[model samples]
Target chain A: MNDYRITTYEPRHRGAVVEFQQMLWQGGAAGNSAYLDWKFGANPYLDDRYVTLAWQESELVGMLGVFGSCWEVDGHGRVMLPCLADTVVAPAHRGGPLFGRMLEWLVERLRADEVPWLLDFGDQPAGPAMLMSGWTAVGPWPVAVAEREVLGSGEGEWSAREAVRGSRSGATITPVATSLPEMPALAAETRSRGSVRVVRDEEYFRWRSRNPLARYFHLVAEEQGTVGYLIAHRTAVDTDDGPTPTTIVECEALDDDVWRDLVEAAVATLPGKVVTMWVRDLAPAREQSLASLGLSPTRPSGRLSQDIHLPKLVMRSTGVVDDAGPLATLTSPDVWDMRGVSGRGWR
Target chain B: MSGSHDVQDVARTVLDCLRNKLFLDGVTADTHLIESGLIDSVGFIRMFVVLEEEFGIEVTARDLSLERFQNVGSISRFVIEKLAEGGGSDKPAEAVRA
Candidate 1:
């Protein structure tokens, strides 16, 4: 029964990959051919060589997808980093050695190709897997949830959006369908702050935030010039409580006042839906701003901890370990920051 | 390393890290790390890193299920399988070696 084989992804395996993913997701992600193509195919950072598949004879049993990212690593300037995306092992194979085998193969490839670092916002049980696979766990990444009502039920009489707009602050919040033209410059300015962050340039915004299949919303608030923008997605998840719609705030760059206005707009538009975002829990100023929006800090005991319903930020280095200067800085939680709506981004 | 040898090695490494950092005096193979409140969220992550580096095993997220990781014996079995067969397929580690 040694029918195990692994290889790089080929176009011929598209349908099979979709079927495999659909089975793994249990139809929640609509892992059809089109979605897979757009996700893996349209990736600006996609290296055809990096998309990997594991097969048991004729069956596509497992997959590890890697998306290319431009990241600002401390002391290294801007570098190309690969983010490990969707990883799925079929139901029958869930608790076996297959996951580690696939990952070992993936890591071997990364080491051979000289990929610098691997970045991912993995939801369990993959998050814990990453830590076990020699990836550094960096958290408690803040998941700020703004619940209008307890248990996220009951609608409020006053709309956060209307109140925000009606205020005497004079800032205006407008929702747009695409990334704003000014976003490229603003994103560049954001990276100039010296925090380890994703390079959210114009290309990244257009590709990541403007996917055709997903209903990602871009809301911009401005008073004098472009104050800031918020990238949001709406989706639901099955929790211990129940199924609840959530407004996922993907990424944002705003001053305190404008941040307030944009969050207000999201709360208004979604009304009762809970709003969530990833913030640097260690940073006092960032935590204070999110606290103002009513998001509490949720940390899981381990990647597999039951509370993993909350999000976590985990990373690992694929770079030369001996050249410890830059990698050491990257490994430090103090220098690194995760600010976005991550983890299986509503497709 | 033989299976039993590897198991003892893993148990030693795990217990040493736990005892020094969290100050737990006695931890046996059957000790429930999570249940006894010995390894909290922070300690669990620290332990994961140490084991992966020491044993050269890849521990995936799904493998963190309580069934496989709740005790020293389970964690040792996991490391053995990974080391023996590279942790990809469910085929018995002995079969691959044979």
Candidate 2:
């Protein structure tokens, strides 16, 4: 530990970063270099120092990624906010001061650079540390689920050889293409409904859809453009009955018909699966829209809450912005009208 | 190193971190660190990190169960077993381990 040092991430450290995440998370996308490149390298919004690395001599012991985003904070208009994600520290160094040291280093740098704020959807096991470091949990937003039975089995199981190409409810739901000319303008138009959220411009949509680890489906209403998208991923969690599938949906600025069509199309694509996503309380209409399509409000709070003390959206201020002015309600979770937010879309 | 000495070194590393980083006090080998408020899940993560760096071991998700990390004695025993299995050591290896 005496040889330990912290520095900004470099391309040479890519392999080490992947290796550290593999050890910390017990291997998954963390071990994939292509995923790392897609996440950090290919991203159009990140700076060179988006990642901070901790090294014990030549070994990469820790990593914390500060994923940058353009956040619309009510009165402040749009401010650049960094979302803390994919934090990992070697287990041997967990009980030491290394983690704290790395956090302080990152916070101070962000402050010095005048970054407005830091936000995170915290890891449950790491909740105590986050709160202890002056982070505020914004509480788990209400989650809605469309169960398999209610969604109704539309077609047989999707075969592996078959491409994810289909349609339902007068819309085309297909695997997202590498590039969509309308994605940039459509994403900006979709998120311009005047609410607090991560700005999803054309570049964001393209980069997010390119995630090597997860697959996303786009629902395009004939004349409505890109109305919605869904990312359905499996979770290790199990209920009294058995294993259940989890899906995240985002369709904030869509018309009623488009939204319903997208939901039906998504459900038809992945039949008999439980689709789940966080819904903002301010947007009762969105919840109502999903409910009308057979989705129900489930008690994901008790089973999925990060911790009793830790809220779902844990935030920390860098004192670089004035929260009292136009952004007075910036820290208040109640003020965010999360109409188009989805589980995968937020990151 | 002797087993007791190794355990003492591990305990000292963990306690020193608790006192310095978290401002904790009066913790002992048998203290219920997690249950007694001396350490939370985050603190437990820190402790594991220090132990790994100090002894050169790779603690995995399977090693996170409460039984293996209840107290100083339990933690030391777990580390000693992991070290004995040659999971990690202070000695230099041919390949780098993150």
TM-score of each predicted structure versus truth: 0.69, 0.64
In model 1, the runs with Cα more than 4 Å from the true position are: A24-31, A148-168, A191-194, A235-247, A250-254, A281-286, A289-292, A299-307, A319-325, A344-346, B1-98
Worst 10 residues of 2 chain A by lDDT: A301-310
What candidate 2 gets wrong by more than 4 Å, as runs, is A1-4, A24-31, A74-77, A146-195, A223-246, A271-274, A289-294, A299-311, A323-328, A339-343, B1-38, B42-98
Report lDDT per candidate. 0.60, 0.59
- A297 Cα displacement, candidate 1 (Å): 3.5
Winner by lDDT: 1
Single-chain TM-score of chain A, each candidate: 0.82, 0.76
Per-residue lDDT of model 1, residues A204-301, tens digit only: 76777644344455667667777767676543223313434455544455455666666666655642346666655323554565555566545443
DockQ, cand. 2? 0.06
Docking class of predicted structure 1: incorrect
Superposed by TM-score, candidate 2 places the C-alpha of residue B20 at a distance from the truth, in angstroms, of 26
Model 1, residue pairs in steric clash: A98-B88, A101-B87, A101-B88, A125-B61, A129-B60, A129-B61, A250-A341, A301-B41
